[model samples]
Target: MRRVVQYSTGNVGQHSLRAIIGRPDLELVGVHAADPAKVGRDAAELCGLTEPTGIVATDDVDALIALAPDCVVYTALGETRPMEALSEMSALLAAGINVVGTSMVWLVTPRQADDWLRVPLEQACAAGNSSLYVNGIDPGFSGDTAVHAALSLVTRAASITVQEIFDYGNYDDYEYTGTAMGFGNTADAERPLTFRPGVIATIFGGLVRNLAAHLDVELDDIRERYEPWYSDQHIECRMTTIEPGQLAAVKFSVEGVRGGDTVITVEHVNRLTSKAAPDWEFPPDGQSGVHKVVVEGEPRIEMSTSLSHPALDVTEAGCLSTAARAVNAIDWVCRSPAGLVALEDIPPTELIRGVMW
Candidate 1:
């Protein structure tokens, strides 16, 4: 059994904590909670578990390192404070702890990451002989792993597109939705951090480049396009309120161009409500969220994956999948070499372990 430490207790972290506790092959050794209120509380209380796991959350990094778990499931918020997150992860790696995480989306393809961002992580892994795997739902399974699996079915390939269509009504991250995404701001206001020039490319471009590398396709450039949808009426969302004429939704694409043609694309259509953008893409009938991959080639394959939980809504289920992707890969990551590990490096069978029958 692998000893595991769960970091953070946010939307994704809560799910990670629960998954660690539920897995019989994994032992919940410790938890590092970011919120002061969460510190000193039982891990079970933080993740809605009825029975206590006998592990209390702590804020002391040194104490967690002292425990020396086999792996750490890190789901902390890295978008706003990437440097800090990197430092934290590097510290853990330097302490010889394997890590699988959803933070630092750019690290989804560490090989293609900027040298400055990649160097420290590489050094940490080298110093401690540990491995790090970073992934999540969109920039992770749907955009790369699942897309590659679909491409294997095509006889010939022309253009490939991976899309995430979701209604964000239930997404309750106010800092992310309100500020980072610019959901409730005026349409004409300065572009949000997510849509700023080169931002999408920096975040999702690694997935495109990774795909290009796997296909042996050289991309001349990576391009980005952003479109915002304005609300026609006042709408109250879980995160923030959208007034009439305010930004309600956004559709953006990051395209990998090869030989002057768009070869690979990562696109997203995110709306506060399904009614916000009738023209933009939506989940399949009766669904609220989906990750779709469209391969325009000889076979013209289109694969759509929708996730839902009996107890949680579609958005929360999606968050759960993000956590599961990281948590499930713990064993594979621990067995891998002492550097950055990608999804392609780990066999599919290794990730399917411990799933319910």
Candidate 2:
């Protein structure tokens, strides 16, 4: 059985943790949490699992690696501190421990950092004779899902768009604040940078850019716009002063030109709360759900599924399943080539059958 270790104890971490523990072919070796609150809780109990292993989650990486886990599942948010996270990833790979992570939205895509980041990771994997893969529901499966959805239609496609809407009633974090996010934009002439390192534009920016490249569409310009609201709004999750109107919305768009010709267009809307103008509820539009994909074509097709699991939103179980696919494919990637890899590079049935098989 493959032994797995996990890092972080947040949304993605929770879902992933449950999945790892429940797997019959995999063993939950350890859990690592940056938060001191959960530093010493049973691995299972910490993640709401009924089966409690004596293993207490810890923040000691050196100790966790000493256990010789086959892989490390990392779901920590590396947006603000990418360099630090990469350092940790480097150490794991160099120690001959495989890694499956979703901290970066575009690591495996061609949009990944080409300088110090990619070079060191490739070298570490080679030195340790191990493999590493980065993926998640948004840029990972959503991009692939949208592309596949578009292929179902015939004729030259004009453009494509993907969007995600979340009910932010329960999201009382600092990340969504208008001042922090720069939500609303007054003019289309100005595409202001929020300076947020991994904003939605920064996160899915590569997806649209890479898609245009793959289609041989010369990219001219990429742009992003934000919309924020505030007022009395009723949210399903909670009652707050900052209601749906007082929320942030992000609109991402990409225009591709072939030989200076307009080839395709991509756009998406991400509303954190309701935009209750004259009449509306909480999160005026977007509600908590799995991402969505829409492709415009001759035989138009669409694929939509809430990526979150039942009874759990971004729990340890989901994180475990996503990370496992990345880990299970490690051996396959090791014996193969180097550089970036995509989910399309791996078979779907094989990925799903990891623990089951």
Per-model root-mean-square deviation over C-alphas: 1.1, 4.7
Maximum-TM-score candidate: 1
What number of clashing residue pairs does each candidate have, in the order they appear?
0, 27
Candidate 2, 1-357: lDDT as tens digits:
778887886766776777777777678889999889999999888778877788889999999989988878878877667788889988888888777777765575634455667788878877777667787655566576456546656576655656544444344334533334444333332333443333545555667667776776667665544444433454343323343344444544444445564444444444444443323222222335445565666656555645445554432233444555555554444444443456656666556555564
Per-residue CA lDDT of candidate 1, range 1-357, in tens? Answer: 999999998999999999999989999999999789999999999999999989999999999999999999999998798899989999999999999999988888889899878999999999999999998898899977789889999989999999999998888887765577788788668888888998988888888988999998899999999988898898887868888998888889899998899999999988987779888767888688899999999899999999978899888998999998999899989999999988889889898887663
Ten-residue stretch with the least lDDT total in model 2:
276-285
Model 2 spans with C-alpha error above 4 angstroms = 108-111, 152-155, 171-201, 230-248, 254-268, 272-290, 307-310, 313-340, 355-357
Model 1's alpha-carbon lDDT is 0.90
What are the runs in model 1 whose C-alpha is more than 4 Å off?
Answer: none
